[model samples]
Target: MEPSSATVAAYSPCGSTAAVCRAVAEGTGLAWDERDLARGTRPEPVDPGTLVVLGAPVAGGAVPALGLERLGRVHTAFSPCVLVCAYGDRDPGHGLHDLEAIAPGLGLVPVAAVLAPVRHVMVPALGAGRPTADDLAAYRSFGAAVASALRDAGGLFDLAPPPLPPASCPRERLELGFTAECDPAACVGCGACAGACPAGCIPADEPYLTDTARCDGCMACIGVCPVRARSLSDPARLAAVRERCVAGWEGPHRPRLVMGA
Candidate 1:
């Protein structure tokens, strides 16, 4: 069941997950297109024969609600698909499990699942300098393997869902109250943060002001600020989160790839 082509869809606020998606697409040896869900654009309908690569960054212990919502809109018909979750050195928790559980409803069959380590948007110190050159290479290798499996399958019906990793973090970690704040002096009134905000919480008129109520704490605004003006509002809170992350996952971690039997 070789696919005609491949499409990579992702909701990466800080682009780490998107980078992994691209690497995997490159491995498939098929023509690939991308749909950035972070920008709030709707992805076009995918043909049944097209291979789909879907991914989102892990926020807390699971995928962000908005990422899941946008991905749910992409209806398919049992199309062969690969699932990916990019995490910030902390426990990937049930992110992959959650994505796999919903794959069927999205008209997708999970042929493979990947958990890639990337810098945490909220706490950069946790998984700093990640999705390194080695990480991308591994994603490409995994993609190639996925392509091989599809090429060997008799048809879509023969494809089986891969076994995903068990849940690691507790559900309590799902809601970490974090918000991006901007420094007035360093902020040059650039609209980059507002434009890059997936939640659209940052106002254009007052770019430095983040509507905390609406912000999902993705930290895209902090990443996009040219002057590095934006950051998590509370240093003590961030430190505590970082401490927990370090205590749980201190050593360097690599991407985890699971393929179908």
Candidate 2:
């Protein structure tokens, strides 16, 4: 990669991935171009020597579907890239593999992949205010090492995704087919939930309507609703998951850097 022309292509559902992207950019000690996938921007094919940093949270045991779809539209030819997957304290399901799967098609060469543990938005009780000081330190330290290696090797960080833990995620979580509903009686019609729906499943005109067919069940509405009126259908069952997953997280999980041969 041309040391000065690196770029970060990112899709951050709750900002953890975005933070990780920026940390890596800082480590490169160069100016970086950023592309936000939510806006439907397809990144242009990068130059042969350009370095790319890819980032997103692990969702539904994979990279966010929409983000991956948009990224796939960008076709490049052997552009070096680093995959960064941020997840709520638990292991990052299939995120690294997801990025690796897309890299070849997108003209990105797999040079390295990093996993950064972040706060869980679903259950704030677990890993709150995470990607903490220690986490950032680890990320930057790894980033600097990768950058140095890339420079030393004349624009090559070619590395395979590390051997990650078995996904072992819940079947329900894997589907992500759940829909969120708003209790109009409890809703103040403040439009917070509607505006917060990432998939645009909520209608602004009605303010209380959620198109179940369009909802991807990201649960963003549940967190942003000030009135606390939005909820998934099976709250009782999912709550059990939150408790158990959080209790078992066993933190002090740091960021990782995997380099290729």
lDDT of each: 0.85, 0.72
Candidate 2 structure quality by residue, lDDT tens digits, 101-153 = 78877878767778877777666666688878777777777678777777777
Candidate 2: RMSD to truth: 3.0
Q: Which stretches of candidate 1 lie over 4 Å from their true place?
A: 171-173
TM-score of each: 0.94, 0.84
> What lDDT is reached at residue 15 by model 1?
93
lDDT for each residue of candidate 1 in 111-181, tens digit (9 for 90 to 100): 99999888876667777898899899999999999999999999877866788888887754467787888
Best by TM-score: 1
Candidate 1 lDDT for residue 254: 69
Worst 10 residues of 2 by lDDT: 164-173
* Off by more than 4 A, model 2: 41-48, 155-173, 188-192
